[model samples]
Target: LEGLAGELGIADRVSWLGFRRDVPELLAAADLFALASEEEAFPTALLEAMAARRPLIATRVGGVEEIVTPGTGRLVAAGDVEGLVAALSALVSDPESARRQAAAARARVEREFSTAAWLGRLDALYLDALGQRAQAPRVAAGERPA
Candidate 1:
């Protein structure tokens, strides 16, 4: 809120934009992402931001640390305003660095969590489980497979 309003100098331009229908497109068009969270499970927001290839400026908590590594974005200590400010400043001062990080983040997602790769791995797991079940022999009332 304050960060967005003050940093961007658009206090009045900040609209709620609640439940936007084209969030994906907006994220894709974004230059950077800033998330301040203390706890999270999967932090799908970070994943979504990464999927959109935007450099993140997130607090070092939850799954954010995993998402914003050296190659992805700047991870600041939780509740560290100075750190956040520094990161924001550095990124703002050097857009090239942010662009590189964003590209690397997208590449990382493509390598680790791409939909095609995820589905292929799931298929392999199912096949392996099925094969194991098939190879196992049924047991009689008082006897088991040797």
Candidate 2:
């Protein structure tokens, strides 16, 4: 909250919607989710915005790098105040761009991280015989899981 007030220079305009019961309403009211967090590991907040079809502006940190790709969100280096400001301004002034990015983000999440894909992989493994599992380790040939 202090970060926002300092960045936007509108500390008085800030509203702390802490523990709001109307999640959908709150999400719907927002055009973007902006976070300048220095530490983020698979940030659930950004993921939630993607799921909610809201565009994001976040610092490029950890798993956030993997999350915001192309049209999903705009990422700036952590502590780059000017860059963050520029991104926030651009998105705020152009609602259409925000919506487009939001749509694309949601689509990417659905295609890449959907529960259906998870279940399908589980079912495929279930269908595979013990011999198939024995034939090849699940590391995709030469590639190893990092």
Candidate 3:
């Protein structure tokens, strides 16, 4: 890939960094995050990018739509290279829009997918379960167990 990058005259534009551990830091340094996967399940990396407040361009697949909604980012049909390129070009050409979208993504992640939000949901579920349990019929004080 490095040789191909050099042959294509894109060696300078592309970094061949491998097995990076500082993903958040890398995303912080990046202008945008691009994912061209044809299929996805959780798309945790996209979430990481959003949490990092980077603009997004990802193929629309699986749970991506649930995360990358209207204002958060741009989505292209999977395998649609032209659409992907167009979206990427648009985001790069319009820095203000990209920044706005990235901000919205970050805000959405914090509001909807943050750890606090998950814990809040868990608390609600437990509260609901406890409420239901309380509603179940109970034997009188001295009655034998049913």
Candidate 4:
């Protein structure tokens, strides 16, 4: 990758920071985030990027669609180089739109996927299960009730 960057005359603009622990800090400093995974299963990086208020350009796969809704981010088909390039170019060319989407992403993460929101959903599920259990026929210890 470094060799390719050097060949492309972009080594000066790129940083090959292989594996660091300060991911949150990195995300906080980014203007935009791109995830070009061929496949993903509930990508936590997408959530982190959204939480960090960075515009996203991710490939359409797995749970990406469930997260990057309209006005939140751009999703292109996996392996579509042209689509990825277009999405990145569009977001970069329109700063205002990028900012808007970033803000919306943060808001959506807070409103729907936050810790509080998750707890609320869990609470509802438990309550519904309890209600169903309560409505079930109770049987005596010694005999079954018809």
Pick the TM-score winner.
4
Model 1: lDDT equals 0.83
Candidate 4 total steric clashes:
0
Looking at candidate 3, the ten consecutive residues that score lowest on lDDT are: 137-146
Our model 1 lands, by Cα RMSD against the true structure, at 3.5
Which ten-residue region of model 1 has the weakest summed lDDT? 62-71
lDDT of each: 0.83, 0.85, 0.94, 0.96
Q: Write one digit per residue (lDDT tens) for candidate 1, span 1-146.
A: 76878788897877667777787899977878888777765677777788898878888886766666787888888889899999989988999998899889888888767798799899999999999999888787889668
Candidates ranked, most accurate by TM-score first: 4, 3, 1, 2
Q: Cα lDDT for residue 67, model 1?
A: 62
Clashing residue pairs in all predictions, respectively, total: 0, 0, 0, 0
lDDT of 2 by residue, 1-146 (tens): 67979798897788776776677677778868898999988987777788889988999998988888988889999999999999999999999999899999888778767798678877888778666867764686788766
- Candidate 2 matches the true fold with a TM-score of 0.74
Q: What is the per-residue lDDT of model 4 for residues 30-109, given as tens digits with 9 covering 90 to 100?
A: 98999999999999899999999999999999999999999999999999999999999999999999999999999999
Instruction: Report the C-alpha displacement of residue 97, candidate 2, in angstroms.
Output: 2.0
lDDT of 3: 0.94
Segments of candidate 1 deviating more than 4 angstroms:
1-13, 134-138, 141-146
Show model 3 residue runs off by greater than 4 Å: 1-13, 139-146
What's the true lDDT of residue 76 in model 4? Answer: 99
TM-score of each: 0.79, 0.74, 0.86, 0.87
